[model samples]
Target: MYEKYDVVIIGAGAAGMMSAIECGKRGRKTLLIDHAKKIGEKIRISGGGRCNFTNLNTSPIKYISKNPSFIISALNQYNQEDFIDLVKKYKIKYHEKKLGQLFCDNSAQEIIDMLLNECKLANVVLKIDTKVIEVSYKDKIFITRDNSKTYLSSSLIVATGGLSVPKIGASKFGYDLAKQFNLNVIDTVPALVPLTFNEKILNKCKLLAGVSANAIISLKKTLFEEGMLFTHRGLSGPSILQISSYWKEGESLNINLCPEKNIFNFLLDKRNTSPKQNINSIINSFLAKRLANIICEENQIAGNIGGLSNKNIKKLSDSINNWIVEPIGTEGYKTAEVTLGGVNTDELSSKTMMCKKHPGLFFIGEVVDITGHLGGYNFQWAWSSGFVAGQHA
Candidate 1:
């Protein structure tokens, strides 16, 4: 006998779980399914285990979308404060990390547990390790797959996420499903991943592994001030990850080696105070020894600060303030935290995440074109979008 559900959500991720909970609460017999052996594999590993659950300051501006206005409705409907209140109610302790990013004090499992517990309370059914072989719509019923068994639902939500972390079961299932219903999908790519360099630069910086410095990585008009790490292949860490979304191949990144202070004036003052200080020594005092050496070598600024003319000092300072590097490419989906593009927002209603072309079909989370900035913003999007759809589904 085929089981029937009021709502069937494919993908037991953050968004799917949230939707299941919401639909269940409304007494709409909901069943959440996942292909993975465990739920929240990505969430369990997010933020180094302490999941960056949500951002305290999340707005539509914090997101990147083809149709930017689409996110405004769902975000306003179920804001970050609502998620925070839920977390608080579960007695889950969390702390604000930085830039309004909040993480659990214990582990990301706390968040998964909280959501699972909420689903149980709401009488939601969760099934894991079930591969969805096919989806068909006949009349008004949705038929979905589970091994050889079939299930029916009045509403189907695809929260299959994106191709960001394939190790955790990321796939193009959502895109394929959207296409079956004639939904347009934006070209997808790795968003919050590390930028890689060509052989020349990689060889040059390979010896400086594990080196990190506060830098302003800018692409186009977007800029992020965060720690950038030097790896054997290229750059990683927060700044690189943040700027990766705005970057494309052949584009240059303007890096401020010292973003907080005016290096020219600082060097000038030091030159006046200590006339005998070497230029390399002065730079070394403010930067890592290897980095200072590299800068000096690259700029051809040799000898002591006392030996260099004021003109040369200005040039050196300007170079330091605006060091530019062109990235060869990104590490791609194998390492990306979130995907940049997915189901086009224009095909779905922002208010409820329901498809305008196909009623009762909703697309939420990273499967949609709305990709949040690198922070707790992505998870917040999952929650908000799911909440909105749960109300209508």
Candidate 2:
């Protein structure tokens, strides 16, 4: 026997649930399925459980994609306000964290429940712990597998997400489905992940573990100002994770330890005021004692500020402001919050997320080539893309 529906969505994640709800709202038959025993594993663990669901300041500039304009339509169609309204309607209390990031006041499960409730209202059917073994198209019908059962649908939406946080059930299932239908895929890489340093630099900064400072990291012409944390493995925190998206092997990372001040000029002026102060004392006056000592010892500049030559002092200050260091690599998908690249955006219609060659087949969420910056940008993509596809798919 063959079961059928107007729409069949795979993954049952943030994007899948949203799409399913939309389809059901349209009075179209829809079924949402996921291989995982639980839905929204990533959502449950996101933002340390609060779930960064959207960013108030989200824009096209904050996203990385082959064709940046591809996201404009969907983003403008269903933005942060639309999702915020849903949250409010469901009485899911939330607060805006730093940099326009919106997080739940309780647990991320609230967001998941919101989506599920929306699905329920629309009468969308959900099947969990269901695995899709194959996908094929014939006679304008899409077929999916779940071990022994096969289902057919007129519209098939792939919201399986990307290969990040695999422990939470992330996989390349969407990419594989896109390829099965002959769609092009971009090379995938880890994003919003920590950087690992070489032994040389790791040893030098070993004692600096657990230290966090406000810094600006520059990579490939992109700069981010946020907290940089020194970890036992390497560097992490907001600044490092933001820059890691643009980082490549062997490329140097230019760091400004004191982003708010001009270190060289500040030191030069301070020297004139306290000409009798020692170099260590002068550094400690402006920076933390431990950090100041580490900077001085790393550069091998010695003695009191008054005893140093003008050129040496200038160099020391310059090094503090423009420290250059290169990372060996990233922590990979195990720690990455999202994948940098996936199904090439060129292969699909930006407005509807439907493949140009395969109509009625849509690829949404992180499976697309577009990847957003750290914060709530990723979730916004899931919402916007899923919203658009749900309308037309």
Q: What is the C-alpha RMSD of each candidate to the true structure, in Å?
A: 1.3, 1.2
Best by lDDT: 1
> What local lDDT does model 1 show for residue 324?
77
Cα-lDDT of candidate 2: 0.89
lDDT of 1 at 268: 85
Shift in Å, residue 3, candidate 2: 1.5
Model 1 C-alpha lDDT per residue in residues 1-393, reported as the tens digit of each score: 799999999999999999999999999999999999999998999999999999988998889988888899998899999999999999999998898999999999999999999999999988899999999999999999878779999999999999987988998999999999999999998999999987867875686778778999888889999898888888888999998888888899998878987988988887788878888988887778888888788789987677777888887887778877899999999999999889999999888899999999999999999888888999999999999989989
TM-score of each: 0.97, 0.97
Tens-digit lDDT track of model 2 for 1-393:
778999999989888988998889999899999999998898999999999999999999999988888999998899989999999998999999999999999999999988988999999989998888898999999998888788999999999999988877887888888888888999899989999988977875677887778999997679999998877888899999999888888899998888888877777776788777778877777677777888888777767676667787777877778888889999999999989888999998988999999989999999999999999999999999999999997
Error of 2 at 359 (Å): 1.0
Shift of residue 50 alpha carbon in model 2, Å: 0.6
Candidate 2 matches the true fold with a TM-score of 0.97
